[model samples]
Target: MTFALGPRAAKAGYGLVAFDQAGSTNAEALASARRGDTRRSWFVTSEQTAGRGRRQRPWIAPRGNLASSVLEVLSVAPAVAATLGFAAGLAIETALRQVSLEAALRSGGRASFALKWPNDVLADGRKIVGMLLEAEQVAGGLAVVAGIGTNVVAAPPDIPTPAVSLADLGVQVTAEDLFSALSDAWVEYFGIWNEGRGFGDIRKLWLERAAGLGQPVAIRSGHAIIEGIFDTIDEQGCMLVRTAEGRLEPITAGDVHFGSVASQGAV
Candidate 1:
């Protein structure tokens, strides 16, 4: 079936495009942007055959989940554009909270969710969502593709750690519902970001929902494993890790292992 944008999508202030299935929403959004589609838009897919993670790892894309990308043209510098990923992450977390709250109003249960530093969402300490943001410089501006995937009904089976789904938490959500919530949340989050907020508000919200703060963590970058105390996120959204030798390291990029201090692993 050919995918079409939802009726309420265009009203959200972005051109919305859909696909029945695709390799990756980010990839499709990038291709669309390269072909002169200038309007801020969203690229969504029901299934992704080759979805990717931050370090090019394969992101699982099961049916009956949320898989989409937001393509935005930014006049901000690369440093600021990079923080857009964190802003997107915050938006996703807010969207999940909205769904969870609605579910709670019906079921009388509390929402038990948290966000991993940078770009992962978790429920009961298991991953339920992942995000990937890609950016490229265009002629007069920058195009950013913010890709997000959430396990609404099914989580991937081959992950290195435990995973969870919204259904598993007794929350019945449709992909369309998630997309709607996400669109609303993104509008709010990006508005804050574009106003020169400089990630201060984003960092605060993320930290409130963040997991593993003040805990021991092992961050792997390439072949090096740096063990430190996960302190807090800095103004730029970098993880602040106080190493064992009294040095506070600002981690710009790495695969973080929560509560792990034994060995270093590939990031």
Candidate 2:
């Protein structure tokens, strides 16, 4: 099936450019922005040849997988734009629930979907979706691109954390169907985000679907490591970890590991 925006997204004036294959949706979106295509738009493809996640980690979406990015230009600081990633996470989580009946049936039962902090979506404790947000100052405003990738047919192998595909969960979902749902869900949550003005509500809702909350966690930030409990995120979306010494430490960025992997410091 070909990709088409949901009714809500179309009505909200979101534009789309669907490609049979692309190097990177995020890179395409940013390049468009630099060329003055600043209107809110989506760049999507099923076969992404070259993509990178946070910390420049390689992420490849083979044929039948979903690689999508949305671009928004606003007169906000990069700090405020960072909070928008929360809305992106929420959108993908909502879309996964909307498209997968098997996932819905498994919810609160066996394998379920949850949002991982910084930018990931987890299914059955394995990574299923990954996200990256990049921004650049353009002529009109700060151009922000939120890239989201979902494992529809296959998952990358030999990763630090195990990855799962929708097929693995008995979810017979197409990338086009999931993208349609995602476009609609993005309209809903991005409205709530309101360019960071409604971040309090986003933070609250994100915690509701957040994985690893109140669980033992370890965050590897560069050469150092911070081990603690996954308490909550702050108003600005910074993760707050309650250490063993009773201090609530704020972490801006890290490679996080939860549950037993944290306790064993295996990550």
Candidate 3:
């Protein structure tokens, strides 16, 4: 099926590209960035044969799933650009909430959707979506690719954290349908980002929807594993963990696992 942009995405002049099959949507977006067309291009595919997530973990995309990436060139510093993950993460939560609400009405049980530390979306304690952010220094500024994968119809059964799909929750949605909602939600939340001026609000909303707050969580950074309270995500989007020694430490990058559900993972 030919993929078409929704009204909001089309009006924004986003360069929409879709493929029947691809290795990785993020790889495709990165290639487009190298060609100097990374203004607001979105690359999507139904199935990914070579997709990899943060820490180079393989992301297997079966036929019934959603995988897409958006590329944007920003003049902001790479440090500031790194926080865009929160914007994209919140957008996914918002978009998926709408879909889940519909499913809730049908199933007669409200499906709880939440944001995990760093940038992941969870539905009722199971990972329903994952995101990966990639960046490269370009001529004028930094080009960042926001890659998002949604478990629309199915999830990897053998993964560390349990995975759940929309279908598993009684919601039937197509990749095209989810992508359309995501594109529109992206525009909405990114506007709230307001060139990072509205990060405070974004942080507030993210924390409000966060999971495992005030709860014990474990993080594996490199060779060391640190267990602490899932304190908060600071304004700069760092995870603040209050260690058992009563010291509050901010983590810029690490893999987070909540309670006993955590497996060897990445953020």
Give Cα-based local distance difference scores for all models: 0.80, 0.93, 0.83
RMSD per candidate (Å) reads 2.8, 2.1, 2.5
Better of 1 and 2 by lDDT: 2
User: Which candidate achieves the best TM-score against the true structure?
Assistant: 2
Query: For residues 17-60, could you state the per-residue lDDT of candidate 1 as single tens digits?
Result: 87778889999989888887868898887688899888788886
- What is the per-residue lDDT of model 3 for residues 69-114, given as tens digits with 9 covering 90 to 100? 9888887877788888899999888888777676567665446889
Q: Which is the winner by TM-score between candidate 2 and candidate 3?
A: 2
In model 2, how large is the Cα lDDT of residue 159? 70
Candidate 2 global lDDT: 0.93
- Tens digit per residue, CA lDDT, model 2, 1-267: 999999999999999999999999999999999999899999999999999898888899999999999999999999999999999999999999777764456553224789998899999889999999999999999999999999998999967779999888778778999999999999999999998999999999999999999999999988888999999999989999999999999999988899889998745
lDDT (C-alpha) at residue 4 in model 3 = 66
- Clashes in predicted model 2: 0
Clashing pairs in 2: none
Off by over 4 Å in 1: 1-12, 107-111, 260-267
Q: Say what the RMSD of model 2 is.
A: 2.1
Pairs that collide in candidate 1 are none
